[model samples]
Target: AQPRRWPLEKHEYKRYGRQLIMPEVGLHGQLRLKNARVLIVGVGGLGCPAAAYLAGAGVGTLGLMDGDTVEESNLHRQIAHSTARVDMNKTQSAMEYLQSLNPHVNYNRHEFHLTPQKAIQIFEQYDLVLDCTDHPTSRYLISDACILTGKTLVSASALKTEGQLIVLNNPPRPPGDALGGPCYRCIFPKPPPAESVLSCGEGGILGPVVGVMGVLQALEAIKVLTARAQRPANGGDWSTNGATSEAAPKATLLMFSTYNTPQFRSVRLRSRRADCAACSAQSTISRQSLTSGSLDYVAFCGATAPINLL
Candidate 1:
């Protein structure tokens, strides 16, 4: 018989006892989550909650990247930062809180802006990417880099009383089959015009709206990393053995509104486009092209006002 997938040490069993007993997250699934590596961009509203849960769940490696420093104003929605951490780097602040929550996980602090030149190199080191930044430039930059690196991306955003979420570029089943899900470029090939974009700082996001979406982002990440079904050695039929095949990950847009009447709308997105510049066979973006400074994601996405947290 195969060895137990997640051979929980005594401390691990004690720490994750509740989760380990869940039917969906039995030994195998928990092991997958433990070995997963996730890179989260921006330690603001979305990143804060998402990171907190992912850390609490015992993901093996968590990479936190942010260029901003904590501000008094960020406390309302950026839950990871505290009064004492004001003026501290956002990545460092979040890391400090997350380590306190679960020191068993490894945390990486990237204390700078995620420029196109550095995006691919950094992205390549992680198994998955989460887009938590509030700027259009960073959105396009993260999406394109994920496409180039073949990493699945769980992207979410919140503004005012609403939030949006999506999963992109999941690995196809059977491994080398076909690309599983559409990438970010597959849905919004172009970013919104500079003046049309709004962020939490400018539009005033509801604290709970971002918190819910961030938790959902973490949920999606867990689903992606740990949904593989395993079978026992009794040679039973997969279906009859109570091990149903997992559904293929789809590209969908989740729109959530917390106005007077809370509402949600999930729309299935289109499949990968053959002409997509980032993930297509004839695409112009490549490792060489990226290294040579050929992609102008910031300009392509249009110029936006500098984010102000005041």
Candidate 2:
């Protein structure tokens, strides 16, 4: 079969000439990337880097979601926007930057906060979803939506000088497999109570640290989309060292100190709790079952207290 021609324009060739020369990302990979669609939630420190890299890499469609507007404080880390863009909707600013980065890539903006319904609706249209939000509530919500929709989620988080990344549901399991890789709920079962952990607003963060992790998130998303990396082993377990096992899913958490040294630790995530309000009812939690009251993920992860007075 003749390889499909990539409708490349002159400017695209000139712009991506270096990348186009690489064996891994030659015309074929570029084309594949150009045809792919990725949804990114949040346009803060982390989302800025991830979205920029993905757009520059030739992802065909980019969807950005964020209800917040740019603020003066964001100038330190949210690199996609500028001092001029302060007070602009983050989604709008990000979309403009992405378009400027690659006109061949289509940019979609959702200038709205993510809700359970919104997460499911928009996420279903994309090949992959990127979580770059700082709030645990948003993270769990995005995770659950992705799991329920069977969409691949590239989840990343950062604070102070540390960050973490993971790929979920790339080669997702069938609904009832006990050994299936753990869902985000399996890793965090509930959302933390508000104000338990210091918000980025209260706690300062190093800008470049988020840049590093966000790029990694984009790289993982690309690897999953292009079949470059094997899906994480069942039970959410993966090893950079190539070790394989049947244990519970393990998350690689990396902590970075101001000295620039990074400490790596792994945690084996439990599979669904039989009592877990999210995944316990079925092999997978139904969309309707994911209401705010269905799970206390924040408390489950020991990140925060329940919001209720109880």
Best candidate (score: TM-score): 1
lDDT of 2 by residue, 74-151 (tens): 989899998888999998988788888777888888888876645666777887889988877677777777777777
lDDT score, candidate 2, position 265: 49
- State each model's C-alpha RMSD to the native: 4.8, 5.3
lDDT of 1 by residue, 218-253 (tens): 999988887764433344344555654445445789
Per-candidate TM-score against the hidden true structure: 0.88, 0.79
Best by lDDT: 1
Task: State each model's CA lDDT, in order.
Answer: 0.81, 0.72
Model 2 global lDDT (CA atoms, 0 to 1): 0.72
Candidate 2 error regions (>4 Å): 1-14, 178-180, 193-195, 228-251, 263-284, 290-310
